[model samples]
Target: MNKDSAQTALLWIVAAGFFMQSLDTTIVNTALPSIANSLHVAPLAMQPIIIAYTLTMAMLTPASGWLADRFGTRRVYFVAILIFVLGSICCASAHTLGQLVIARVLQGVGGSMLLPIGRLAVLRSVSGEQYVSALAFISVAGQLGPIAGPTLGGWFVQDMTWHWIFLINVPIGAVGLYAVRRFLPTHGETQAPPFDFVGCGLLSLCMIAFSLSIEAPFSTHRAAWAAGLFVLAVVSALAYIPYARRRRNPLFKLALFSEPNFSVGLIGNLVCRIGSSAVPFLVPLLLQLQLGYSPLHSGLMMLPAALAGTVAKRWIAPLIRRYGYDTFLLVNTLIVGSSIVAFALITRGTPLAIEIAILAVFGAANSMQFAAMNSVTLKDLSHEDAGSGNSLFSMVQMLAIGLGVSIGGGLVNLFSAQWGSAALGFRFSFACVGVITLVSAWIFRQLDVAPAQPKVRAPATHSAGR
Candidate 1:
């Protein structure tokens, strides 16, 4: 019993790391406008602050597992916390937009390592019987971050200063650093094969090009620059395929996608997330700029969606079990997409209650879609593929978020130019992205009637993207 209790306490340490990483991802969104004003940059140009963090994470995530195996988990985890805390300090002290973006990149370097390595620690230490419960416990911390991040960010911006958003991590990270040294076990390094630096470079380049292209549409050389970047991005991504195929031990083996569902599921996830991820970034701006909502009020408005998403978790398993992954995902995708479209209709005169209801529906459906999609994508992977598959999925998830923000922001700017109104720009952008989401439903339709559910019991296990 004491041993079990000790393990449980250790899980809390892991959860704290997850919480800090997840919180930083979201906590800055509501504060973006305030941060821009403080830095003397336009609000729209601030997407790079958000993109830089997720993009850096995507670039570095593939190596996280290897780092833990090559070095001891405890040492690497301690350094990760140290770097993250120091990065937070840099972010608070940054005087210009370029300095802030650089700080975020540093923070992402640490954030990229935190959850995956912490998860590896838990998986190595805990028994199979205890794994699900331990993971579920840690995931609750991740979930709570989304719930608390916006509210905390808004309050800090309103009551104090935008810098407090980053400064708040100092104390939490300090305690986490100490806990890592005290409670974390000194595990032996694995005799894993040599790391694949070449493949990693190719994939990293691909992600950078693709992410940059999406943001190019908003630049001064909009058409020509976007075309050049788009072509380069395609070439780089395609280059990785042949390079991976020729390598002895690639970063992610091509065979992992032999299962039809995994391939389609991944493609669908990337496409669908490109639309859904933008809503969080765009919604706050819309509320503040068009609807005349305050930062605090906009943050509070997010509560209905986040709370409804939490409440909607229970509905997922039963629905999937009864209807199967294919039916559930197909139907749920439409609901999620349409709800996004419905947001385009919210004008200054729209009832607050009605707007909340629309957001709640989108939240519930999107949450359910993610859980189902994640399960189907990985449910078929063998134990050997589990680690790499999870890492690849995570990389794609972050990359999609960066792409989503870029695309949404670019589209808004484009439409704003055409319509001569930022409000109309937001409305048009929502509709276009919503349609993009709806098209992804066809990918889910390709799944077999009875799809495999993931063995991992926590509903949130597959929700790494969230």
Candidate 2:
């Protein structure tokens, strides 16, 4: 009984890591305006701050598993926490936008490693019977991070300075460091592969070039620079395809794409996310920039969504089970997409109560879409494929998020220039995002009527070394 209790405590600690990771993603959104004002940058130009962190994480995520396997998981996990805490401190102290962006990159390096390593730890340490429960706990906390982040960020920004948003991680990260160093285990016997530096470099270049090109066209008024970046992205992507094929062990293991479901799921996720992913970024910007809401009030507005999300989780699994993966994805995708449209249509005169209700509904549907889509993507992969598949999926998710900010932000700017109104531009951009999401539902049509449900696999024998 004591052993079981100890095991539960360790899992909870890992969940905390997951919580911090997701919290970091949303917490900064509400604070973006304040941070921009303090840093002397325009509010719209701040998308890069958000993009840089997620883009860095996406670029680095493909290697996280291999690193954990090569070095001991516990060691990598500890280093991740250390970097994360240090990075958080740097962000809090940063005096300029450039400094904060660089600090965020540092933080992303750690953030990229946190959940993947923690999830691997849970998979190794928890018994098979407990796998579902363990995952369920982590998912709940991680999801709550985004749900509560805006609210918490708004509260902090209103009550204190935006720097405190990053500072809050210092204490939490310190505790996590202690817990991880003490309780996380080592995988001592595994054969570690050589680091795939060439592939990693090529891949990172490709992602950076692609994401930057998307932003450059909208951010700066330099058409030549934007064109040059676009050309670079195209060249970099082509360069990686052949490089991945020729190598003995490529960074992505391109062979994995042969699986129909995995390929479709990944592309679907990337394309779909372009529309939905930027909502968090846009929501706070809308509330603060156009809606005339205070940071604290905007943050408070997010509470209902987060609270509703908690309640909505109970229904996701059942709906997916009853309707199957394809149906759930198709239907839920529409719900989420339509909600973004609804948000876009919101105007200054929209009743506060109505706006809050709208945000809450979008939050609930979106939370469901995440669970269902994530599970579906992994449902068919074999045990050997699970780790790589999941890692790749995570990389894609982050990359799309970065792209979403750039694409959504760029599009909004474009529409603003054409419409000659920032508010109208935001409206057009939201509608565009909605249309993009609506189109992605067709990807789900590829799935069979009785789509296979991804079952939670049992973890093998598992430990806390310290």
Please state the error at residue 365 of candidate 1 in Å: 0.7
Tens digits of per-residue lDDT for model 2 on 1-466?
3767757867877778878878888899899889989888878778878888988888787777788888878888889989988999999999988898899999999988887788777888889998878877777677678767888899899988898889889889989888876666666536878778898787678778778777877877788887888888788878888988888877767777777777887788788888878887888898899988999888888777777766786787677767788888888889888988888878899998889888888778876776666666667777777767776777778788888888788888899889899999899889888878877799977864473444522111000000
lDDT of each: 0.84, 0.79
In model 2, what lDDT does residue 34 have?
94
Show the lowest summed lDDT stretch of 10 residues, model 1: 456-465
Model 2 Cα RMSD, Å?
3.8
lDDT at 351, model 1: 95
Clashes of 2: 0
Q: How close is candidate 2 to the true structure, as a TM-score?
A: 0.92
**Residue-wise lDDT of candidate 1 within 407-463, one digit each (tens)?**
888888989999999988999999988998999999889876483443423222213
In candidate 2, stretches whose alpha carbon ends up further than 4 angstroms from where it belongs are 448-466
**Least lDDT summed over 10 consecutive residues: which range in candidate 2?**
457-466
Alpha-carbon TM-score of each model against the true structure: 0.96, 0.92
